[model samples]
Target: MKKLLILVFLTLPMIAFAQTKPYLSIADAERITAAAEAKAKAEGWNVVIAILDDGGHLISLKRMDGVQIGSIDVAQAKAKSAVYFKRSTKIFEDVMKGEGGSRIATLPNAVGVEGGLPIFKDGIIVGSIGISGVTSAQDGIIAEAGVKGY
Candidate 1:
């Protein structure tokens, strides 16, 4: 019995650490994209939406008809920026308006845009969403709607 107890204690930490961390599944990415797309359509905005997993990996991308081709890369960059910075891309945008903020432009993969948002589940970041093609503020609004859906 004492040996069994010792063995249990030895394995306890492994069991605790094995708990699954929240992750953004493909379905979740699709749902987020759908929500953002709906918002863009309702606003009559042609846009591109990008979703990235917590590790800043692309999960999904959707481009509405008539949106500029450039927005596709822009959307992905914004999502990556959100994941890399662990915050909204809008924060970088705001910082860019301040003195010394130009340095933000030098940060690799850091997009100082207003349309990237981090998606959180149970207070843990699961992924991020980014939108492009419309005005920065409008893209932000759409992104917000998407996060709300999640």
Candidate 2:
């Protein structure tokens, strides 16, 4: 029993260290925002773009000319949901399309929208991006362009 306890204690630190997540640099955030904005413009979709670090803190935001004011908060919320949940908002939206779909709506901080995506580098999620002021599919496309910046 003493040996087992010692082994458990030794592994606890490893477990904690493994939980560490990467953060997005300011330059990277800027690149992502630019890419998202470019895609929105290329498609002629006026949109708001938001980027958030892995901890769900906003890093950068862009509001294209003519975008609705309400899209600013919605874009940030979608980015937060992506980073906080460590998955694309599309996944949550898909889950809501089938049986028991309503259960996903109960999850705290889960936006379940289609415009958010996690940004990954070296197979680790470093941040996320979200776009709004367009159709969900178009917003998702723009967000994907932003994620590719990393």
Quick one: best TM-score, which candidate?
1
Q: lDDT winner among the candidates?
A: 1
TM-score of each: 0.87, 0.83
Off by over 4 Å in 1: 1-19
Instruction: Please state every model's RMSD to the true fold in angstroms.
Output: 3.3, 6.9
Give model 2's clash tally: 0
Assess each prediction's global lDDT (C-alpha) against the native: 0.93, 0.89
Candidate 2 per-residue lDDT over residues 18-90, each given as its tens digit: 8455668999999888888888889889999998888888889889999999999999988989988889999
> Mind sharing the TM-score for model 1?
0.87
Worst 10 residues of 2 by lDDT: 15-24
Angstrom error of the Cα, residue 147, model 1: value is 0.5
